[model samples]
Target: MPLMRPRMATARLTPSRRPHPVTAAGAKPAAASTMGGTLRALSLLAVLAAAILATGCSTAQIEQLKHSRTGIASGERVVILARQHHSTHEAELDFVECVGNALSRGANGLEIASHSDFVNGLYPWFEPAIAPLNPEELPALLARPGVAERLAETGVRYVVWMDGMTERVDGGGSLSCAAGPGGAGCFGLAWWETDARYEAAVWDLKHVDQAGLISADVTGRSVIPAVIVPLPFISRPQANACRGLAQQLQEFLVVEDQLTR
Candidate 1:
């Protein structure tokens, strides 16, 4: 991959920014407490789910990737922390969805706890740590600083981090032909090629929200490891890739026996 200079990080928080109030006034302490927890949980899931489609798009290759994986255990729950920097809420949501799907398949006992609403975050460390790509290229930045700490405080056990980018390369073709008859002897040949690809990475952290020094793993490829041919130049490839990844992951978890029903 050709390296590009990093672009300045920017914040694009989801339109829905206010955190759901955990407790409502004028209510009994016990009931309020239970309601607060339930509301927060529901809000988180809603936010995460919305983030999945924020990027706004999909493709056939993405479809294949979606259907490839399996289910998680009958009922083990997992948490998703999808923070985005220099990206849209849609992209973030797509990532959350994708990871949720993957877990369902890879771990039979796993279930998807609701995901948190999209948050505006920064990727301050990724700059020099990961070369070439822009800050936007890597989504893990959202987790590096205090974001992880915040999530842990929220009672999240595991975190799935996601980010993506799309690029176009030189696409050209060559051909050969043999001589046959008169002046028009040789046969004419033409080849068409387009070099365009979108990649989405889903990272898993065992206990990130709590640990400052958590080891994050690039769990696996969310989309088809293979690139799409004749890239869709008119559309947003990365968005599509992310969407596919989310759906594929969902499918994988279910099939892999990670998430049942």
Candidate 2:
């Protein structure tokens, strides 16, 4: 997604068409006035940033398909993995992290193993060049010496292989800003649309079979209308997708009959 892109330079307002020559006393006030103007401009930018973060609209839908029975017992944990080896469809790091965090929150949240530590423990096996892309490859991977033992130590019940990314699908509108000696202001309006489509395959390591598939699709439109200060009504589909996916993933793994503290 494109972030707020604005290039602004420090500018100040001077005495309006002064007919008299500038004196030392007058020069001091102009300098002070310039400093005050810069501070105000900075304050406005801070407000804009807050506005952009606080105001956004997003739509999300989630689907879950169970391939086989799936649930996690007590003391078991889950690991979130992404398809970094893929060329164009690889999931981004931020989305992966966001999902992991979301899954680990709330009172009934699931346990999550440390992603960095788990990957490091497997080392070369989980590396991009050698990583197993799907559950079918797991048997061969475990047959490798030391791979099964190392994986067993993590007590991971499922491995979620995340695939997909957020894309800028469509956009329109124009916005422009200019700065000069008189001060600076922005005008015009710009808008863009982004779609986040992500799907994760839950691999049941304990059973060495596929558990279920969860998919999240979200669409959003972000707009910036600049009259004086650019007011951004940013839409974040990625965040919404992450949240929805994580919730569904949690529900998919926890059985109501078997709740563990």
Which candidate comes out best when scored by lDDT?
Answer: 2
The number of clashing residue pairs in each candidate reads 50, 0
RMSD of each candidate relative to the true structure = 24.6, 13.6
Q: Give lDDT tens digits, candidate 1, residues 1-261.
A: 212222122222223222223421112243334345767445434433332333122222431222112233433344554335544332345544654665556434355666533232223332323322333433464445685565444443333344433434222332333443432111122222222233333223332222111111111111110011111112233443444454444443344433212
**Candidate 1: where are CA atoms >4 Å away?**
1-152, 155-158, 170-236, 253-261
Q: Write the per-residue lDDT of candidate 2 for residues 1-261, one digit (tens) a residue.
A: 112121112112122222123332343354346546767556545544443443344456677666665677889899998878877778998999999999999866899988788899999888888888777898998899998899989988798889999999988878899899888767666878899999988898887877778888887767665545556666678987888898888887885332222
TM for every model, in the order presented, reads 0.28, 0.73
TM-score quality measure for candidate 2? 0.73
lDDT of 1: 0.34
| Model 2 regions lying over 4 Å from their true place | 1-57, 180-183, 256-261
Error of 2 at 139 (Å): 2.1
Residue 97 of model 1 has an lDDT of 66
Q: Who wins the TM-score comparison?
A: 2
